[model samples]
Target: MSFPHVTIEGYPRVGANRELKKALEAYWAGKIDEAAFTSTAHSLRIDTYRRLRDLGLTEDYAIPADVAYYDQVLETALTVGVLQAGTLDEEFTLCRGNADTAPLEMTKWFDTNYHYLVPEVADQAFEPNPERILTIVREAADADVKVRPFLVGPVTLLALAKGENPLARLDELVDAYAAVLAALAADGVEWVQVAEPALVADLVPADAELAALAGTAWTKLLNVDNRPNVLITTPYGSLREGLKALADAQPEALHVSLAPSVLAEDPTYVDRVLEAVHPETTLVAGLIDGHNVWAANLRERAEILDKLQAGHPDVAVSTSVSLLHVPHTVTAESNIPVDVAGWLAFADEKITEAVALANRDEDAFARADRAVRTRAESERTRNAEVAARVAKLPEGQVQREPQFEGRKEAQAELGLPKLPTTTIGSFPQTQEIRKARADHRAGTITDAQYTEAMKNEVAEVVKLQEDLGLDVLVHGEPERNDMVQYFSEQMDGFISTDNGWVQSYGSRCVRPPIVIGDVSRPEAMTVEWAKYAQSLTDKPVKGMLTGPVTILAWSFKRDDVPVSVSADQIALALADEVADLEEAGIDIIQIDEPALRELLPLRKDARPEYLDWSIRSFRLVAVDAEPTTQIHTHLCYSEFGEIIDAVAALDADVTSIEAARSKMELLTDLNEGFHSDIGPGVWDIHSPRVPSVDELTELLTAALKHVPAERLWVNPDCGLKTRGYAETNESLKNLVEARDRVVASL
Candidate 1:
């Protein structure tokens, strides 16, 4: 039973035990030296390659040794020597910008939750540092694994970057890439995976022109002396417009994702791709899902592969994209029910499934079939009462009584200042704050001691805000581990793990809670914290809660039921929490739905259903507020151009969005049609640089041209949980001063 050749597009770099994140954080915190950090990272890379070899993938079938210092995009920049300097401090500052340096812009990685540092191109001849890629290849070869080096394609790299006419510098970048490719071939590497994910996105005329130029550049690279075989891989969506350009490039191989793309739903999409692909090229059919945690349906996947192989016997099997998006394995999850656990597949299990599919292993297919059946039965009987409650939800449960004007009049009685300033929830989870929580968890300190420490911290933060002349104050979230995990910890039907960490960004990780059954709040999640913070200040305190949509998006939700059902249950629980906070005499509540736009479907035709349920879940929690309660929601890491109408329909009295990165360019869509009040963030909190008062004033002035002065609120882009205390203080002071200036001008 010889199988078609199988390969992994890329493997997760956050070590099986998350050693990379631990090492990086320790080095950043000054707990470990650079030598120690590099040793740990290098050991993890060796271990990863050895583990893959043990899994029976070797020789030509082995995956390339693709490890990142932080993110793959940032790795690409380092490999190409794109930064001004190659020092460690310069690299760190490039990703996490300092006071004197502006960090590269960050965005969601092509419809996935992972964030990537966008490359910044300038007027310089880019040079290639083949040492990084060459070092990994040599390390993997030492472990007896033949590897193909991976690089982010030049076109995708340029398309995702910020600068003036980045495409104009394509020829120089291509030359650098060709040099790297030739070096890999010199090092005995036979194949290289050049990922061009931008090809899968919807391309405009400018983008298409860039794609054409990229194709021409790659064609030149293929002709380079001693160049390794190039396999262009595009994942996450269709390459409808860019496929012809890619075909014209005429690489040795091309990989296309079948799931989450047109090939899965429309047969015509496969036919079209086959028609454009060159006859001499080997087509790698991405049959297994890389982004999700579901076990592959091997039987169905085989059917699709059979059809593909019938036309082209050169087709191979692979994962749709990199397996970095999912957890490493579900084998360690002992608390979840066996039936549900059997239905789940993580990164490691997906790799095993891919090999089984390529070999057409009957025993593995039978086991998968049985597990699928068990999961279906388990899902049907798991929560009949909750499902019935969702089915019977009354009409208009998602709509608030009284329109914007009525709510505004009631809210005005609180007497907040014009152009009022507020910090996004959270001050800083400083070392002391984190230690207090860790000590409590380890039973090294008494619960009473922990509570007192948190209370004192809250008091300090409250006084700091008051001294800074802020109109609204937050408790600084000293006790919260994360926005979503905090509420999940207090709720029923959620399971959390000790080492379930997944990389959120460079040196930051999140342990996503698993929702196994019906969700309900056993007690109020945030009322005590909000009440305590309010007790210390005369100014209004915003009760913060992670909205239902964010909770659902961030958590490992139940698969037996639709996500909408889980979202509804969470919403009902939050609606109860909202009522409790209002009864606790809290006048303002902010429900942060930062993931609202991130969860929208990539395909335009499939967006309405998702938008409907997502908006409904938000409304279910927010609409229950009193007229004077002043419900607010915050969104981040999103562009509101296509979803502005849906955002307006959420009916929040006020919506604060991430606008500082694009300099409030997103407000152009809202200026003409949006009716709700807005707080277009006056400063970018993602960067470490403290914005000046003049900078904030300019942003406020820009926002005013869109949102009227009366409808505008002054605030930072997002939560302050990731910032330092000194920077947070300086930024907010500037924000308040900018607000005062704007009021005086009016």
Candidate 2:
């Protein structure tokens, strides 16, 4: 039992200043050498440990050396020797894919917004690769910053594997893990944090198979010779019946989330967790919320810590989930209002809270109590008009009127072609576009200058789309910063940060807006841009907007109110924008709900409530649109099988999804239950490799079997914002050519 009083499963790997993001992007672009990239990672690793140590976390397993060079799951896959990549270039290809090999499929890690590279174990071998994690540990050791090494647990890695049933490979995988453990032990490591999130990710009342699987995996791991002390962290809790399996093998310590959302469904949750753990095993109470930025209710957390620590043999305190979900520090954000910043706690601040609770610091408790209380009591958190609108929201199932069948004919009146070609809202965000945006925000460029530059870019994009012979087009979104952040900036009751960058997926960072109070649109977001883009071309240009559910999902939402209420408030704001877009003569509007499936409750019992509110919030956005308006919604990168019915229920005239990466696998599920017009993406926008005309044609042809050629829209997997113009131009041309050939053949 060597775990520290305050420890985390992992720290934020993206540097406080986003050093890792810059380094990785530079490496990917070939703008930097391997030595330069390695140096940057070395610095980031040292910086994380030093920063955590300075912020009241003790040395020796207190700071987990979770240096996610790209992604933690990818790191774990390498450690277990499952990913099978040989070189740095090959490893990156496993993440981003090349001309031949498609990148591993990525989905949201559990219910959080962060996406993890799913392990491809269908036809892969398992062996130990200790060099990756060990190298990082040694790097930290050289800096005299002792830290714990972290890994995804054997059971979890197998549980989340794609393409094949990996249960049979458990014994083999455990052997590989054992080798890694032995290597760490020989390297003078004292402890390791193994994340078994699978145990709790989809916890049920009782799952005999899962329990047995976990029981066997833990038994093998703990029994391995020369193993380091194991701290098995079942983060993002709701362990429920899964606790018995974990308790069977008394680990050095166990980490569990006490956040209500995870630990719900039982009044005896705390008691059950305490009871389940062996008397010798330390109990690490994950009482502080790690997913959101709100300051911990130290008073309430102290009460729980007091119960856990009072005479308990070895008790510590920590966060309910990894701090990776949150930004590094609110202190880095000089632009955020002082009053709002006071209520928030980023990764380092959260760790400080954990240390305080562990040490039973009363002064810290008093300070946190005041901050938490002030947020509750503040008038700034509430708005009368926003409250009135939320109250007036229509009751019942809230389905939109004149469903897809009725609107299909009205939409056909516009006479769009078969296999209509379009992008998923944005074109490549060039350096010029980024600079203009930055300059405008920095006050170096006047409003007129920025607007003119954006209009020029939009016109260029429209011309490019026209040249590519796309049936529909986009304004290219040069004026926007992020899909969610752009909308949050113009709305009331949201705090947009200047430097609060958290990793969304590999080197792609987003400053998630903080939803502070009741949300309302001050004027219209994206209306003038839509109107101007439409004015440039007679062809329909999509009036792009991020949907309400997505905006709420992406933001650090208010803890005081239910998240559903926040979604509705945002829906109302976006509804106003949708109306304005429609009034501006932009009929082909698309409100992207890409995070729709991201926020689905992990538990089966809890999903109905989430689906009801989330789907209604989406419908409310487009419910007021005209029949011929053709409101299109795009969802991407998620496992949409779970929400196919809900996706159809959304009742958008058309729904485009991330189908390319999954090779139209969703079409099978969609064909069974879905009724609306569908777009199964033909191009994988995340990768640098462009799909050939034949590849796109093949994908479009496959899609036509499930969805009619007329209903099947051809597009890329997601927005082209992260891509470059050269790749984007070539890809669009191939995509349109693919569509033309398919249409001609039909």
Candidate 3:
């Protein structure tokens, strides 16, 4: 049984896809020419393969084909013509202004906070991506490692494609995928794992299209001549509806998650899965902790495996999902205590755990079992302190200063615009800016040199904003690498990584710092940047900072502390920064807590306390300022309808939310009772697919239906840093034009 056991599931340190992000940014900055950008990307591809081999865990390698202009995997599929394109010339021309150069449309990847390039489908142009797969395999061969490269399965591709009715598109896409697989078989690649992860979504509960897409793709994949063994991966949860279809298709294997939640919910879910799977189909049991930072107990894992073994002795144990969700290594996190470090497992450690389980070395596993037990015992000692802290939370600690009316009265005295337009506080973080900062950190450049470069970037950003006629200008964040990370590095309580990379969305990754101890701001956080920007621009410069909830969400939070406690500590630090920014005469400080939605407790019972603390923390940070300070908060892709009260409780003067692509449905609730000022997005800027003035005009019109036109602040869905300068310029021009047209009509 060459069923080489491997686990893949870990959080990213920084952005979603780091190398690809670097390439795109380099290309945008013209630091390296197009050829050089492409060449460096090729080098990153080689580096990824080498890293996988260096780790010594290779049953599979997630190739960088999906890391592309929009997204790598999906882009490769589109470039090779797996999906059918419709009205391409028209939509392309509308979005990019050039039908000849209409790049594929990319959007957010379902709900998991990642984005992938959309597959452009066209029947006349179908070609197998042989070179991509071959190149990956050759890299593996060069490293002397046997591996299976990953591809987006047809079902998931079909589900995410652009069309009115995605279900109808599945039939043709299946055959396209089959042709691609057949070509791979001809190229002598005998094993591949098609990921059908979307089967775990809430939509899959009722959608039959998911099943049909899976069945069609798998049937074709197996039917290919001399094909590789196919392993269908459905991580996160059991494929509730598509299980039977997946079972019937019955390729070489079926991978199901055995994460803590999955195991606790229903032994029946797995039992049914094992029963439905064909006897020939091997069950790839995900036996390690892939999501959390805790080291897995071999004994606990063994017990779960024993249950699986009771049903089928031939079960293979692996990770719950790809290790791409977790940090790369815990080695460089110097701030975390060594004792705690031993109890935790990052991506690299999870790989070793998967190997031990799969190899069936009971004796070796027993030692790991004992080590985990010892660590757990030590952790048990700290539980009392954690419990004590939770019990001692003061009633006043969770409350804020004053009501919205009082704050608003004070804010009015400061004088700000009614329909104030602002950005989420970022300017183009160019290479020259980053290099100067890096050089300063390394002592190759003086503080004066670095600050001067940043000042120049800020001045340019201010000039751009004045030219564009934006109401509130940002300092362009030239001095900061990341919002949370920059602050974390400056403060004493946090620790960061040299090479710790985590995927944010697509190929853009961020190395979030680890908050290991009590967090306190030793000095002012963003006062210099805020003050300097204010100096350059007469227009109100919005001081930007990631809110407490976001810092907690983005960082590798300590398990020893409740999130509420960590949030408070961060809030205390940010509150100081907020005060300093206010003192510096900065109006419209936008505290972005985008991760607030992401950090919502998965279960309902535990949600209120989270909201109570999360909201109080936001208030703690912002409420201290006078009402006229214009305490703005920006959130994206958040469903705040249910938590409208909590949203109100934040007491922000303004909240810019994502509503453009998602049909402005959030406005329905906001219209009914939302008290605070709100600025819903008029168009999505994240996608390269630009909105037309008419499209945005209609969107703004709809936005005006819920929000008063006087209060409306037209802006893009999120930051435009990732977008090309050309696209950004064109899109903003359209947005401003649409706003003007709407205002004229009103």
**RMSD of each predicted structure:** 3.5, 2.8, 6.3
Per-residue lDDT tens digits for candidate 2, residues 593-612, read 99888887766778888899
lDDT of 2 at 194: 92
Each prediction's TM-score versus the true structure: 0.89, 0.93, 0.75
Question: Across residues 214-262, which tens digit of lDDT does each residue of candidate 1 receive?
Answer: 6787788777888877888988877766788887778888888886334
Poorly placed runs, candidate 2 (over 4 Å): 27-36, 83-90, 97-103, 122-125, 131-145, 203-207, 264-267, 310-312, 467-469, 671-673, 687-698, 722-746
lDDT of 3 by residue, 148-235 (tens): 6567776776666665555465656666667666766776666666777777664432446667666766776677666667777777
> Weakest 10 consecutive residues, lDDT, candidate 1?
201-210
**Candidate 1 — what's its lDDT?**
0.82
**If ranked by lDDT, best first, what sequence of candidates would result?**
2, 1, 3
Enumerate clash totals for all models, in the order shown.
0, 0, 47
Q: TM-score-based ranking, best first?
A: 2, 1, 3
Which residue pairs show backbone clashes in model 1? none
Candidate 3: count of backbone clashes, pairs at least 3 residues apart or interchain: 47
